[model samples]
Target: MLLLLIGFGSDSNKGNKSTKLTVNETFVTNDKGVATISGKTSPDYGVNIDNAKQTAADSDGKFSFEYNLKGNSKKSLRLEVSKDYDDNTKKSKLIYVKPSKKFLANRESLAQESSRAAVASKSQRKAASESSESQKKAESEKAKVESEQASDITRLSEKPTDEQSAILTQLANQTFSKKYPYKGSKIHTILGNIQPWTKDGNVWFAKYEATIANAFNAKRDATLEIRITPLSRDSGNVSFEDY
Candidate 1:
């Protein structure tokens, strides 16, 4: 009977050793501000961290829990484990945790990059606005110039001055000479009466009457229409068509 009691006592000691809880002494917080506490305990044992809610170990006697540092640089954790079959509860040593240096550095770098991107975006928007305003201003000036030119053309076509009339007569004679280059062909008086017509606002057509003698000495009255296109305020292009 004494030998049997000794063997039973040794078995009890082995059971207590197998149920002992073990935990990591130190942990580091990740970039997400969370620290993971892990430990080994008896299978299906209830594990508690810092007196919080209890969690059960897996079948393999492994357990883990995440603790939020709440943006703190350092934190302390205590853990306890208990099994239904064991009357004695096991406790772990104080666990220390600190934020990882690599995490902090990466966070700072990302913040700086974000700040630079924001500045660049603001500058781009400002530049785009300025460019748009400049383009609008240029377009407005161009429209004003076009309006003035159209007005000038309308005025000139309605009532030509003496100098303008002389220029028109010379242009007409030159055009007639090109078309009728016969050796003895000659033109008499170009018409004094000029009637101007226009299709579009920018161009004018004027009809004139004249007398011309061919190389055969046969004389006939001729009618011609001239197209006048203003090149600028002081210059124009002239073309002729027989009417």
Candidate 2:
């Protein structure tokens, strides 16, 4: 990557912006022999692969392309970078694509890792659900003891304030946006319901459901739990995680 940057600089005029492109090691392949190449480049740069596949960078200069290497023995690729299809301003690089064996191995490893993660996530959600159930059960059992002599009573409060709702929504959006298909695909996060209950007054929890669509076109949904601990009347710390 550094060598490519230096070569680009040496080949470009001083006043002109040097063609800067870096291919991160995010290449992946499957048994079908198709490779997905992803990386970043200078913003607004036009990228072409072997003079066939072409794409323009996003506002942040990130780019991704999928190339089918099925049944091809040749392992080299030509990456050409330019702006507005100007050949005179193009910088080309010869990239030796990694062998399919490496990509397959990596894909297998990733599949295993994803399987493990799904299992772990399932366990975590189950545990959280059980914990919440037990807490509710304990509270119900304590209701008998909360007679006239009880010190204080827990209460169900109204919906969160605008500020609190905004903070929670922001946190949820960020968390959901960082997840899979939603990370890149044009997806909207629709927050469903907010259920908040408080005891004493310091710690509070708000549970909500979010629907993510892009990969499945709104057929899937996810539940999130947000914990809000108020430090004062107007401020607090908010944290959340996907379940």
lDDT, residue 219, model 1: 64
Q: Against the true structure, whose lDDT is highest? A: 1
Error of 1 at 36 (Å): 3.5
**Candidate 1 CA-lDDT value:** 0.67
Candidate 1 lDDT tens digits, 9-114: 3211122454666777789988876778888887888876666655789998899888777554677666667775344655445677788887777678888999
Which ranges in model 2 have alpha carbons more than 4 Å from their true place? Answer: 1-17, 24-28, 72-74, 102-243
Candidates in order: C-alpha RMSD to true structure: 14.8, 34.6
Model 2 residue 74 lDDT score: 45
TM-score of each: 0.41, 0.33
Pairs that clash in candidate 1: none
Candidate 2, residue 134: CA error in Å?
Answer: 81
Give the per-residue lDDT of model 2 (tens digit) for 1-243. Answer: 455433445322122347667774334455566777777777888888878747878888888777776443546777777778776566666664444676566667878999999999999999999999999999987875553213221221454444445554565455445654553332233445656433325555666675545665544566666665655443455665655
User: Would you list the clashing residue pairs of candidate 2?
Assistant: none
Predicted candidate 1: what Cα RMSD to the true structure?
14.8
